[model samples]
Target chain A: MAPQPKHLSGDKAAINEFLDQFDVFLLDCDGVLWSGDNLFPGTVETLELLRSKGKQVVFVTNNSTKSRADYQKKLTSMGIPSSVDEIFASAYSSAIYISRILKVPPPRNKVYVLGESGIETELKSEGIEFIGGTDPSYRRDITPEDYKGIADGSLLDDNVGIVLAGLDFHVNYLKLSHAYHYLARGAKFLATNTDSTLPSNHTFFPGAGSISIPLINMTGQQPTALGKPSQAMMDSIEGKFQFDRKRTCMVGDRLDTDIRFGIEGKLGGTLAVLTGVSKKEEWDAEGAPVIPAFYVEKLSDLMG
Target chain B: MAPQPKHLSGDKAAINEFLDQFDVFLLDCDGVLWSGDNLFPGTVETLELLRSKGKQVVFVTNNSTKSRADYQKKLTSMGIPSSVDEIFASAYSSAIYISRILKVPPPRNKVYVLGESGIETELKSEGIEFIGGTDPSYRRDITPEDYKGIADGSLLDDNVGIVLAGLDFHVNYLKLSHAYHYLARGAKFLATNTDSTLPSNHTFFPGAGSISIPLINMTGQQPTALGKPSQAMMDSIEGKFQFDRKRTCMVGDRLDTDIRFGIEGKLGGTLAVLTGVSKKEEWDAEGAPVIPAFYVEKLSDLMG
Candidate 1:
């Protein structure tokens, strides 16, 4: 466990003092900006205040189910105008990492994707061939039986180089079994995010983290998590923005994912909010990993 | 770790001599009888030999996906002929235990099943009302939106006494979230088994054990696992058959499930067999639990 940082309480004066120190703001989506469809009170005012002070804000979400285009649309409809480039999604981060690290030479190798169209589109855009056993056209038509051929090694004969696990609606036993087989055969296993659960309408639902964790436990193999709270996400930010690590802050709700990510990535500091998936009582009850540098009632509280 | 038995070895002749002392057989399915489709060679001969010597045998499988009838059919197809009454499935065991322990008035109490038809059928047969949520019937038509109504305590208005988790085909985030809610609200959390993996067509698939373990970890709650390898299963056998625990031998292929069950239940001895889920190399590897009383190449090796 890392040392806890001094926390500025949710009081107006303390929050304003903490916000004045950061130049760049990296915010988490579901738990920080909004929970599903409902935005935290005063989110718009907070963003306006942050921008007024010349702080570059990026909406980073681990949910690979939605593309950047989808997030941009959602944010716009929610009274927050965000550009596509400003929205950094796990799918985009994973694609960039795969393209750079495991670059198969031109006439790129086929990838067996167990993910949504966001991942499919990203892989295609990167000059990678997608060899899908399930119906590529119909999103929910992929069943466990479809991937049985892959598990038995028949699908890999066509130069399949990587097994990418993002968010697939049709994830089943066979797909997981096949992914394990391909991974055992030295194929790279790239997961979009390690968020165990995703926010739904009322409660959290199992995400890519739940599925990927089991495979990792069974095969004794760990896939590179390319989503927020991973260091890879921070690396992407640092590489692209040329921002000073000690000057950037990760502001989010969930302690396990957001705050831990900030601490592990060696980011400047973390600001935890109480308006999302996690509550103050729950957060305090279970001793949080690293104490946030600041705590606020909502994002707007950051500017007093 | 328990003390290693004196006659334990991966030898054929020594195993045969040791098997002559037992008159009652308690067999675990996944690792003992067969793994996936391939039947362990000499299993049928071993069973026939036991029956010839007036030994009573009972097949106990912790997999709650199927009923005793399903196991009967599966075992019969694989050359192991046994009636439904002769086999004990976890679904049946769970239902029996729940009915006996809870002692809810007939047709009054409701059970939320996070399992398959086997559990539902058994609960219904016991005159317990089945509160439907995420099963095969509802999962096909319902989206994440439909789950909000059930999870937030709207649908559970009546007397929901227990939350039974067995083998669910649609064990999604929504169902698990709802189950957690019910459990937190003083409802009983009863699981079918704790075996992490089950034998599939050609390999091991994630079982109820994997699903239940995570929930247990998350909730900091230990559920009553009414399945084989549990002390409850062994007690059920002793109560029903009036069998002497000191003279009975539990035969299985896996050390964690089968051999451990026998030792923990204080049964006489255990027979470990090869040609199933557990390999000799795995057993020989470091840090495994107590060795079986006898280890054979196959079940039939005990007859000679």
Candidate 2:
């Protein structure tokens, strides 16, 4: 059954009571914090208020385009104080899952990445040596005749142990061929997230799921996704912060990712904010897979 | 139930009787005709003999990398005289399905091709205008920052009515982004073939399916595949040759594509030759989805 979310009024007493129930808050970035480059009103004040009340705030984002430090910088630039420790981006989570959880070391444990420099940065920071990511060799497009050499496996690295895929703008057959060869030969498959589309400038475009799908189809293997609403990301947060799952609430705009992330992780509660993907009709609609435990006009509704 | 194939010995009378039953022959190129660059022994002779016996032979191949003319030339150079009319490649079938069958014409019917020059060539031959395939603009790999312009739909052609994908050597993010945009905007998604891997020089590499999977995943839509084992190609053949289905026989080395193609099309008969991917054990495996109506050690085994 879908979670029945209590529609909280803009009543200050009720909002304070609701906020009192959770010691920690897991927040989604794109929709709740800001839409594209524009920040929503009361976002910083709400975060500051939560922190002043001793409530821990963890930023959980499925955007694999940026590293944790990059997100921290972006958040700080937006007048919201965010440190790397409080940020849990999918790219960093993927790196942590691969290096720490999977224990994939350098050299033989080399990863073939099909993503941006964010993934590269995280992997490098974790001391996980990888190839095919942001590499100039794979950037050039070739004709059908040129594929003969690639298909011959002459140019592929022999030591790809894991294939980590994310939101790649340069996804080409060269990287795909190498990933296919490795996966077919029993290499581990990993993905930062499987978000079908990403919201940018109030429009949705193909997300990391687009990059990972081809690999999934070719290899006939599903990847171990390291982003919301995957359990791995929640586990990563739990491992690092030691936050009590029962006292932590997830707040976001998307039902499938944020609310589902909280539900799948068995968190304290999930709050759906309006200012993003899901609408009131959708929440009111019957048979939704992931209904939030609470509904508010926006994340900053508590600020009033 | 799997079709029970009658195993034929090298008996001349039985072979001749089996051959006489079918007025038309549909042959798979890769395995039945040749393995990579080397033709199986007696393949050319078998085709010649079939022609001499007044049996019509149609080359049906799932390999979308080469155009019909290319295949015809390859066959001619290899001592097998094949006309372009007798060749039904997946590339040609995709073009036919998009242009003639689907009736997507020029201007607003512009197709975004995600394959090699073969698909481009076939589409061009059919007077179907397309973009992205073999285009120098789409072949360059870019960083995540580069995707911003692509994702914003600045680089995409607005008149894309169909996104046709096949075996692409230059499969890259730029093409995928455009395809994704088009598909998300309700463009028809079509695939030349959904074969996962292509065999080349004793090695297997990522095939057309690898290129299409990302689109499939991103759009949550399965493409209408125009290749072997699909009724679309058979329909195309029927439209062209008016061959009697009951009097037609499919000869292939693989049970999945060749035999299944015949089964799906309900052709006169399906013959499995053991000169390619499937072994005798596989053909004889219990509960196989696609068992040929007849089996031979090789096409040459019936040539005595």
Candidate whose DockQ is highest: 2
How much DockQ does model 2 earn?
0.54
Badly placed stretches (over 4 Å) of model 1 are A1-20, A102-109, A131-151, A155-158, A167-170, A277-288, B1-20, B34-42, B102-108, B131-136, B155-157, B169-181, B184-186, B210-223, B281-287
TM-score of 1: 0.86
RMSD of each: 3.9, 2.5
Please, what is the whole-model Cα lDDT of each candidate in the order they appear? Answer: 0.71, 0.84
Deviation from native of the Cα of residue A141 in model 2, angstroms: 4.1
Alpha carbon deviation, residue B293, candidate 2 (Å): 0.6
Candidate 2 lDDT at B292 equals 81
- Report the alpha-carbon TM-score of model 2 versus the true structure: 0.94
Q: What's the true lDDT of residue B23 in model 1?
A: 74
Could you list the iRMS of every candidate? 4.1, 2.9
Clashing pairs in 1: none
Query: Compared with the true structure, what per-residue lDDT tens digits does model 1 show for residues B104-193?
Result: 664435777887777776676556677653445435433655567655667554577777777665665445656666666667778888
